[model samples]
Target chain A: MKVVLHIWRQSRPSTSQDFGQDGKMVRYELDDVSADMSFLEMLDILNERLTAKGEEPVAFDHDCREGICGTCSLMINGRPHGPERGTTACQLHMRSFQDGSEIWIEPWRAKSFPVLRDLVVDRGAFDRVVQAGAFISVNTGAAVDANAMPVPKADADKAFDAATCIGCGACVAACKNASAMLFAGAKVSHFLHLPQGQAERDRRVLNLVETMDKEGFGNCTNQYECEAACPKEIPVRVIADMNREYNRARIKS
Target chain B: MNWMLDYWRSSIGGKVTMAITGLLLFGFLVGHLAGNLLLLSGPEAMNEYAAFLKSKGALLWVVRCGLLAVFVLHVITGIRLARENRNARPIAYARPDTIQASLASRSMVFTGLSTLVFVVYHLLHFTVGVTNPEHFTMETSAGGHNVYGMVTASFSVVGIALAYVAFQVVLFFHLAHGVQSLAHTLGLHHERFTPMIKTASVGVAALITGGNIFLVLSVLLGIVEVQS
Candidate 1:
């Protein structure tokens, strides 16, 4: 099968042109495609061709293509990871596309995560947000017995739901205003649910929120775009929970 | 105290004010809508209702002052938050494939501003009688302002009634999203109750707008009258 992909190409950040002015779309025609081939495999084929012609291959972040690492980030066809819901780009197969379709592929677009090259964005902003929120100080010792601390079944399950967030930054990419509230909410809720995460609750919420704002991410407008694009299917309800946490912190010290 | 101030100053802090202020204004809407519905009963009852409010002069003024304060705060916070949101994303998407946000969610500013404009226009047209001076400034036989006479006269005009109803469309959309978003801000989420909340928001928007429109159209079409 054959398909045409309009890939965003940026040699550098400063050299800009066109709408969304960060990058230009460079068209690539691939004649040999297998429906069974994964999307990243197709990209691998393209990179091989580009390298053969001595042209610079597109730069994208990906590792653990099995989808656990949350590294494979691509805004394929005006979406965070193609059209399918709860699926990452690496997991998306060529079978999703029609033979002659012109697919527009771009990077995760955000001021916080600027394009370093082609599709590779500096997602260190996410790390900083996580660092701001994650503050668990416990003495180093042998692991405690599972029965040492008793947690309700509901809380345990909810914590696990939030704990699954792999920090993909898809919520940021999918949002029109690029709000990071969903990402922040997941982290905040993970701590809120556990007995271990209770000591610095107020500071954690305040610091993470302040850090998120400083990172230049937009405020959540209850759009639920982030939840929709999230490969892990993180619920938007976590955001509402985060809002409560922030307010409680404010009413306190 | 510093922490509290900083909390309010945060972007989410500003949203907290927005939610509270919006709910306060919606409370006022219920009272305002109830009072206006008196137009259906003719001049005497409506004028009496107006006098009842005027009788509580000091309390009325206090409520009005509070209303004005909240209104101004809502506008300021909304504008500031909107500007910050815009600043957060300096670059526009070439083809932003929006998935879940509703049309009302995206158009809050435009609709909100239009609602604000209508509010001013409405006050001038009825309260101060500046917009439709001849029809708006009627005097009651009891030596009080003829509130019902003024209201009926203004709504009798086809152009004025239509213009007012058009603003109700803006109000409907604004209230619909505003009410729902307020629930989210307050951390009130129950999957079973969300549909109920959404229905109630729409119902409130409809009831208020529908009540106002019905009163105006009744006067215009002679279903209600200025006469006893």
Candidate 2:
């Protein structure tokens, strides 16, 4: 099948006036794309073609093509991870596209997630936020039995749901304001639902939320765009939970 | 106090502040609209309601001052959040699009600022009576302030009535986003209940805007009029 690709291209030299300091969309036509090929595999084929033609290949991020790793990020046709909902770019197949369709692929857009290369962004800000407080502090001694600390079924389910978040920055990419509340909120709620996370609960919310703000991410306006674009289908309710935790933490502190 | 200041400085804090103040302002609107609806009950009820409010004296001033403080906070925090939001995305998408963001949600800042301008004009026209003093200087036979006469005289003019209706449309946009935002900001959400909340947000906005527009149209269409 034939697919016309308009992919963002940026180099370290940054000499192109059309692409700006970061880069701009460069067109590539691939007539050999197969329906069975995953989105990353399609990119691989494009790169293989570019290599044979002695041209620079389009750059993108993908670790595991299995979709569990949030390393793959792309704004395909203005959507995070293409049109298919609850799936990553690595999981999106060429079958989702028509034979004669034009595909526009760009990097995740956010101030904190600057475009490092073509379709690749530096998501170090998410790392910094996680480093701030997405964990529980515990003295490592003898290993405790997981079942010993029985958690409520509802709470455990909610925690596991939140734990599915892979820190892809799609929430920021999807948000009109580039808000990371959905991402940060999921992190906060993942811990808050556990008894083991109770000791540092207040500190966790405060630090994660503050770090997210300091990273220049915008506040949530309840638009639910993040949820819609989330590959994990993380609910906006996590954000509300984060708000609740932050308020409770504020009052307690 | 220092902690309070710190709380207000956080993004979540700004959100909570906006929610609380926005809800307060919404409450004020509900009351204001209810009072305005008294116009339909004839001149005596509308004017008497105005006089009753005025009769509160110090209590009325207290409420006004509190409302003023809330309004200032809401506007200030809103502007700050919006500026931060703009900065968070220095570079925009080449072909930006939304999967689910409503038109009202996206245009919140514009709608809010427009409503702010409309509010100032509204106060000048009615509350302070500075914009149209001739229409403002009406009185009832019972020696109470003639709010019915003022409202009727103001709305009788097609242009003035249309202007009020225009502002009501802007206010509708603001309220549409705001009412639901308040619930979310306050950390209130349930999977079963959120859909209802979203619907209620629009419903409440429609009711408020509809009531206010209805009053203007009522006067304009001569359903309600100033007593000769």
Task: Return the top candidate by DockQ.
Answer: 2
In model 2, which regions exceed 4 Å deviation?
Answer: A13-22, B142-144
Ten contiguous residues with the weakest lDDT in model 2 chain A: A13-22
Per-candidate TM-scores read 0.95, 0.96
Candidate 2 lDDT, tens digit per residue, B1-228? 888888888999999999999999999999999888898899888877888889999999999999999999999999999999988887778777789999889889999999788889989999999998987887788666788888899899899999999989989989998999899999999989989999999999999999999999999999987543
What's the residue-level lDDT of A100 in candidate 1? 87
Question: Fraction of true contacts reproduced, model 2?
Answer: 0.78
Summing lDDT over every window of 10 consecutive residues in candidate 1 chain A, give the lowest-scoring window.
Answer: A13-22
**How does model 1 score by TM-score?**
0.95
TM-score of the second chain for every model: 0.95, 0.97
